[model samples]
Target: MKIAFIGTGLMGYPMAKNLLEKNLELNVFSRTIEKAKPLEKFAAKISNSLSEAVKGVDVVITMLTDDDAVEKVLSDQDFQENLKKGSTIVDMSSIKPKIAIKYGKLLKDQGINFLDAPVSGGTIGAEQATLAIMVGGDQKVFDQIKDVLKVMGNPTLVGPIGSGQVSKLANQIIVGITIGAVAEAITLCEKAGVDGNKFIKALAGGFADGKILQNHGKRMIDKDFSPKGKVSTHLKDMNNILECAGDLNTQLPISNLIKDMFKSLVENGNDNDDHSALYKEIERRNKN
Candidate 1:
């Protein structure tokens, strides 16, 4: 199938590369041409313009930074005009549920299918093709594109349009809280003269054990804050979560606290560091 991929940044670059490896007819576009140039070596057609990239493609996949970036692309007249009728647009960015639903309705009116298929799993997962893709769209459409998605990750059709983003928000909430919990526990143990590594090992195979505790806990222990998922990105997710909650007339107290922690990190210029750097924030709090 002919496909167009936009936003070839950190996560997007690897995802588009996986599609190219499958020998699909792929056109890749990035506002920054350098990012798309590498994919050309993989036999991807690099488009000079967004319209040029999308024209006549059966599907267009976007893995952008945030809702604003996604909206800027989707709202472009050139982008809308270039999309062929009956084509599908799968947005794999973590964005607001309301925005997803908004675009879903707008695109549906034009006979185009839109799916909010946000993902979880950092850059490593993107490179390894093990990302947990949560999809929200028509079942039939999902089935039609399932194979293409599977090239990058395991895609699940959770419900209708916007559900994928909701699921991602839930995932982020759990992630933020768990990171905080792990950091706090690890810090407490360290303060009490306990070995953080051994402490985590003690919790292994117990209910507290999870991907976050194991993977992120390891990052904490090693002081490796390189960006698997950036602190800024998680901050954006937290803001989106609270915005969504406010729209639904609900409260997320723990998420709010986590949001502030992320905000503090970003304010202190840790925006580009890994989200696991939240541990550093907790570590700072215990410094007395």
Candidate 2:
């Protein structure tokens, strides 16, 4: 199908590349053209503007940063107005579920289908094309697009519009908490004068083994905090989780605690570091 993809950042870049590999009719756009440059070699045409990018495409995919970025881009009159009535817009960004619902309704009014299809598995997953995609939209629409999505990851329809974002928040909570767990576990090992790397290796064959321990745990002991997923990024999702919970009259005490940790992470000027950098915050607290 003809598709338009916007926001070619780290996650977007690899994802769009996967689509290009499938030879789907795809056009890409980035606020900074250089970010979209890598896709050009793979036959993805980089568009000059939002309107120019999305013009008349059957499916518009956006993998942006947060709610504000998502809103700002879709709010473009030319971008929305130019879409065909029966077309679909798939937002894979980690936005609030309620906001996704709002966008769903807004698109519905215009006779367009909208899907909140945020994903997990960071840039590594994006590059590996193995992300776990959680979708929220009409079942029929999801079925129709699942093939396209599967090109980049495994796609599942969790519920109605907004559910994807909610699901993503769940994923983030678990991810953030687990990262903290790994960090602290490693720190404990180091404090006991044991090698943190060996600690991970010792846990590998047991119940503690997990994707986080295998990947992020390795990053932690190695002191590699480069941004596959940034501290600021998960912080945004955690805050969105708390916001969603508050609106729903639910309590998420642990999520609140994790959100506060991320707050300190950003304040310490490591917001751009990988979310695994939660280890640093843990280190700070332990020092006190």
Candidate 3:
């Protein structure tokens, strides 16, 4: 099927490449053309403009930075005018559920289909094509695009219109909190003269063993805070989670504390580091 892929940044680049590798007729665009250039080797049609990228495509998948970026592209005259009727817009960006619901209705009113299909698994998952894709939209549209999404990861229809975002928020909550827990535990281990690496080894196969403890925990031990997922990005997700909690009249006390820790990381210019850099924040706290 013909497809248009937008936002070829860290996650988007690998995802677009996967689609191209599958021999999908793909058009790719990023505001910065350089970011979209590598896909040309895989036979992707790199477009100079959003209009050029999306025109006549059967599917338009967006993996932008945030809600505003997604909205900006979706509302652009180039995108609006060139997107053909009946084609689906699958927004894989992590955004507010309310915003997704609002745009889903707007697009539906214009004979377009919209899916909020945010993902987990970081840049690594995108590269490995193992992301957990939570989709919120019509079942039929989901079935039609299931194979296409499988080229990147597992796609499951969680609910209608906004559920994908809600599911994503839930995923982020667990990730953020666990990162904090792992960071604090590692700090405690090191301060007590215990090796952080052995700490992880000691916990393997226990209930505490998980992706975060193994993968991200190793990142912490090695001081590898490179941007698998950015601190600023996780901070944004934490903020979204709290906002959703507020709307539901619920209190997420631990998430609130974790949000503050992330805020501190961003304010101190660790925004570009991996979210695992929460280890830095915890380490900073223990310094006398």
Give the number of the best model, judged by TM-score: 3
Question: Positional deviation of 245 in candidate 2, in angstroms?
Answer: 0.9
| Candidate 1 off by > 4 Å | none
Q: What is the TM-score of each candidate against the true structure?
A: 0.97, 0.98, 0.98
Off by over 4 Å in 2: none
Give the Å error, residue 209, model 1.
1.3
lDDT of 3: 0.94
Q: Looking at candidate 3, what is the lDDT of residue 58?
A: 94
State each candidate's clash count. 0, 0, 0
> What is the per-residue lDDT of model 2 for residues 26-106, given as tens digits with 9 covering 90 to 100?
989998999998898899988998888888888999999999999998788988888888999999999988889998999
Q: Ten consecutive residues with minimal summed lDDT in candidate 1? A: 279-288
The local lDDT score (0 to 100) that residue 187 gets in candidate 3 is 84
Model 1 lDDT per residue over 150-189, tens place = 9999999999999999999999999999999988877788
Q: Which scores greater on TM-score, model 2 or model 3?
A: 3
The residue pairs in collision within model 1 are: none
At residue 139, candidate 2 shows an lDDT of 99
Error of 3 at 101 (Å): 0.5
A best-first ranking of the candidates according to their TM-score comes to 3, 2, 1
The residue-level lDDT of candidate 1 at 200 comes to 86
- Global lDDT of each candidate: 0.94, 0.92, 0.94
